[model samples]
Target: MQETLEFPDLLRLIDERSTAFLAAVAAAPSLDAMVPTCPEWTLFDLVEHMGTGRRSWAATVAAGPRATAKVEAEGAPAVPREREALLAWMAESTRQLLDALREAGPDRGCWVWWGDSQSPATCGAVARHQLQQFAVHTYDAQLTAGDPRPLTEDVALDGVEEFLVTCCATTSAWPHEPATIDYHATEGRSWRVRLSADGARIARLPATTTDEADATGTGTAGELVLAFYDRIPLDSLELAGDRLVFDRIVAWEPE
Candidate 1:
């Protein structure tokens, strides 16, 4: 895996991108317009989800495992119908989350549902996770507004690594038998992901010539990251070798 971003850097990214996301929400022509990428949600629903999710994560950071139940409780805060009110509420909730994360510091223990238990439950992990969440949702918001912008190469590359380790490797939900596929980012990073009946494993490959594996996907880091999340289709990527292998891997849903 690539080296993770420092906690402070991740926090900065969350702040920057989330501000942009809220701006998109503010500028949306109609809150009722459907988000094409997230077909089930309207713009209003998306903003509400993002805001409430921040609050839940903030609670988790502040209270550790004990906050899980409270975060999951029914009747989470509702998004205001008025756009200005919704924006203000989102801003306040985001600040609460940022404050909680900052007070906890990078090394402070917190609760994380994904990845190995042995992995440190630090505020740094929370920041990193939230950065990706904010970045992807920002794209969703922009795409909804017909102004899609790619994430920066650095954030996209790190997001690819985080998705593999935190989401893929830690789950037993991949139903496929043993297989390997390589993902090559145009920014010049590549990863080999191995999926088996047991689970998944991922490794960063050296930037040297090597034989192609069962499948290979070449794209910008941002494209790869979005495709990995299924926010974008696999065909958005340039694929070589077995398309089926790549499709199966991407199709796997975490349990």
Candidate 2:
């Protein structure tokens, strides 16, 4: 089973990363400036998305396990237009999420969208998934501000698994032939992903596992995570074997 960070640890990172994102927003050239990564969004839009989404998730957690959570899209309050008010709203959004998580605790069951396939119905899973979103969007904010920073090694490592479970693994059938891809991190961690009509299956490779995969990608943990999120191109990693299959897997998205 994939082990996620402890609940408290996840909370800590979420706070740190969200704070960083807010700081980037504060220092950004303009709220109207376009985000290169998310072309459809401005800095204001980005903040609204994160803040509002966090509030929605907070409601989900507070509702307890298996409860139908309220959604912001369903007549929620509008986001503030002013920078200072928006920042304060975002901060409060984070605080609410943190407060909800703390009260529910990790083991408490929660209604998560991933179902039982990618994650368990627990608040801990919500925290981990939220961390990934914060990490990625934080990078988006930084990149938009022309001040991108590297992800912490630990977050990047966990992010790979998180991305696979939450985004890559799906019940949809793969149209292409079966293949295996190996990811080797400079830090000695490695994972092997088998792609087939059965969908994508990922497992941490045993030390004895052979290196002869149909496609192999090598890079630092951070680079791999960034590439998975499309913050960086696949070519940034050293690759070998079937480029076509690798590209196909990289481009795969759930319906």
Candidate 3:
């Protein structure tokens, strides 16, 4: 399994990306502008989700390791209707989350959705996943505001692994024909993912490989990660083999 990012580094990203997300929303032409990636959501809805999500996760982390409460029951405040108030809520929610994460530190046991995966149920796990949450939603915010930017290489690469570990490669059965797909990032990283009725497995490929796959996707790290998150089209990548396998794997979400 790939290592989780250093606790401090993950926290730093959470802060920076959340700030970027808020900045994007604050500068948006209109809060009502629809997000292209999330066809059903407006910029306002996106910000509200970000704010309340942070709030809910904060409560979960604060509950410590043995806690079993669902995140949705954390009593996060509803979004304020006013523009300034909504932005303020988002900012405060972020601050509280950061505070909670710092207090818990990296190894402290905490509630996390991916406890069964290689990632432990700890404050660090929450921080890692939340960083991706901010990173991806920031793109949503930027896209809504018409100022989208590519994710940093470090964030993008980490996100790709996180998505696979947390969202894919799960105990849940695949319930589809067996297939293998390869993802190659221009920066030299690669992952070979296998899916079967049993479940899914992912292996990090060597710097060079001769083995073939049912489907292959090649792109820069940013593009590959964004495509995995469905933030961008898979067609944007150089693809080979069964495109349907690529589509199914990308669309699969952990229950």
Candidate 4:
């Protein structure tokens, strides 16, 4: 299994790449490049979205048990008009957020709207949540800037699995079910994820063998990651048993 990371992992990756995104924002190709594996966003909007997400998480975490919703459908702050100024603003905004997250620390209490209503005091799960969000979006920004390689398989798979399990609560695109899916990597790693009306709950796989799933598929980790994001072709899956379940998986979307 890939070594798991705490919330600070994101703080680190964000610090390293935020500047990369800043330096290339204007020169970066038009926002039209769909985040390849991420699909729903253009590079421009993805960076803008993540930049705002940093603020949203900070605000929510700082607020403690009572977090409020303040969404601006427009997404992100307006650009400063001057290219250099915009980059600086973006760069500064990200760094400031990094500082805010650091000062608050993972132990600070938080009320998150997504995933297993959590307090930052017990923050390992929160780290997984924020890390995947930031990592995928960072990939989008990097892709827009013309560097398209994905994060390491373990990282991508973590995010991809997180997205799949959480899709029911986060979007109407998925057909919600109480059924569970146990994910296994050929490389001796597995995560058992359950999706239900309560949303997603993930746990480490049990050592004992369970019945074969209603359906199963196998492929490279990267391909599985893209499929989870609706970026890869579902038919590409190698399935055994109850193949129709695969169709439903293809239909899922966060929207």
Candidate 5:
């Protein structure tokens, strides 16, 4: 895994990216515009989802481990029809989330649904999770506005590592036979992922290694991260080795 980012740094990123996301929402010509990346969601729905998600996470950080019930009860708020009002609401939600995270501090114990029992449920994990959420949704907002920008290299690389370690490892089923794939990001970070009927395992590879693998994907860090999450098409990547192996790996849906 890539080195854990400091909690304060993660909060800073959340602030920056959340601003960008709301800006895109503001620039959107129509709230009814469908987000191509998330076909089921219109721009209005996306904004509400992002804002309410931040509020729910903020509540989780404040309540700590005892917050699970509260988190579940806090559903997303209804999307506002007026454009300016929606933008204001988004800004307020972001500010509230940042305040909650700062108050909780890095090591403060908190409930995180994604964290395994062995992993410490702390404010840091919530911050990291929110950072990735902001990054991805910002891209979604931009894409909807028809001027998608790639994530920064550092954030994309960390996101790739996070997805493998967290999402892939927890997937419970594999439709195809076991296989291994190597992901080499143009940013010079790489990881080895082993997928089987049992589950998936991931390891960060030494930068200089040249070992062969059953399948390999070469792409920019942002492309790799987006592709891994099925946010972008697989053809966007440069594939070598066994294409089927790579396909099967990506095809697995997390339980």
Candidate 6:
């Protein structure tokens, strides 16, 4: 992994991924189609979620940090007629966000809710969170459309790394009763996470889950993120050790 990566690069990567995800979603046939990972959410629901999510993030970054600002974008209307328009809107909104982040600079100071993460430059939480959301949502769209692609290990591992550190390691998002979690990616690639009770942690691990774990989960890193995010079912993972640990890890919020 590169040392001290600037947030602009992360934003660029996220922007590329956002495009990739939208393309996959466009590959889908119908909004009513069922997503394999998120059985309850239809393709329509996933598309709407992505659009609204982009709007919310764009608003958040623009607001310059606060205690959860209310997003102005109207909630998804009751009747969605043209899914294609919504998908295009998602793409353009994400592109605009990338532009904003580039202008925002990693070192640029700003207000934030977290104690140590008050700076937009250093506060890397929302970036990683949204990336994972796009990844899983893309996967969901792919599965729902009955067309799946091999998730890039480099990309998936990046997501796995960020999720472990930002979400599992710290309860900054939850702020109370925060338990940490660690993700270990097998397959002998570079990926793992160790989230503990003290401000949660993330780092590359030499091994995936094993008998030594409180619980173990085995799957592709992409699958792991999807499973963790509630987009995928529990049975999808091959588990061992303490299932509770794995379950607890997945139960955390997206923030």
Q: Point to the candidate with the largest TM-score.
A: 2
Collision pairs in model 1: none
Residue runs of model 1 more than 4 Å from their true location after superposition: 65-78, 117-120, 171-175, 209-211, 253-255
Number of colliding residue pairs in each model: 0, 0, 0, 0, 0, 6
Comparing 2 and 3 on TM-score, the stronger one = 2
Could you tell me the TM-score of candidate 1? Answer: 0.90
Instruction: Score candidate 4 by TM-score against the native.
Output: 0.70
Which numbered prediction scores highest in lDDT against the true structure? 2
Candidate 5 — which residues are off by over 4 angstroms? 69-79, 115-120, 171-177
TM-score of each: 0.90, 0.92, 0.90, 0.70, 0.89, 0.72
lDDT of 2 by residue, 1-255 (tens): 455588899999999999999999998999998988887899999999999899989888888865865444345567899999899999989998999999999999988777635667788888988998999999999988889998888888888777767666666767789898888888878887888878777778876885689999999888888898888989999999999998787567645
Candidates sorted on lDDT, descending: 2, 3, 1, 5, 6, 4
> How do the residues 1-255 of candidate 1 rate in per-residue lDDT, one tens digit apiece?
447788788888889998999888877789998998887999999988998889888877888645544354235566689989999989977898899899888887776877462235677877887889999999999988888889987789889887777776754745776788888999888888877765677888898857668888889999988998788888999988888887777566757
Return the TM-score for candidate 5, rounded to 2 decimals.
0.89
lDDT of 6 by residue, 54-122 (tens): 766665565554525434444534334487776767776687566655666554443333433211233
Candidate 3 residue-wise lDDT, 17-89, digit = tens:
9889989998899999999999899998898888878888877787787688636525556689888899899
Between candidates 1 and 5, name the one with more favorable lDDT: 1
Q: What is candidate 5's lDDT per residue for 198-234, written digit by digit as tens?
A: 6677888997777888999989989998897678988
Give the number of colliding residue pairs in candidate 4.
0
- Over 4 Å off in model 4, which ranges? 1-3, 17-27, 30-42, 70-78, 115-126, 164-178, 194-201, 206-210, 220-222, 236-238, 249-255
Model 4: weakest 10-residue lDDT segment is 115-124
Question: Which order, best to worst by TM-score?
Answer: 2, 3, 1, 5, 6, 4
Clashes by residue pair, model 5: none
Q: Where in model 3 is the C-alpha error above 4 Å?
A: 72-78, 250-255
TM-score of 2: 0.92
Better of 3 and 6 by TM-score: 3
Which lDDT value does model 2 have at 11? 97
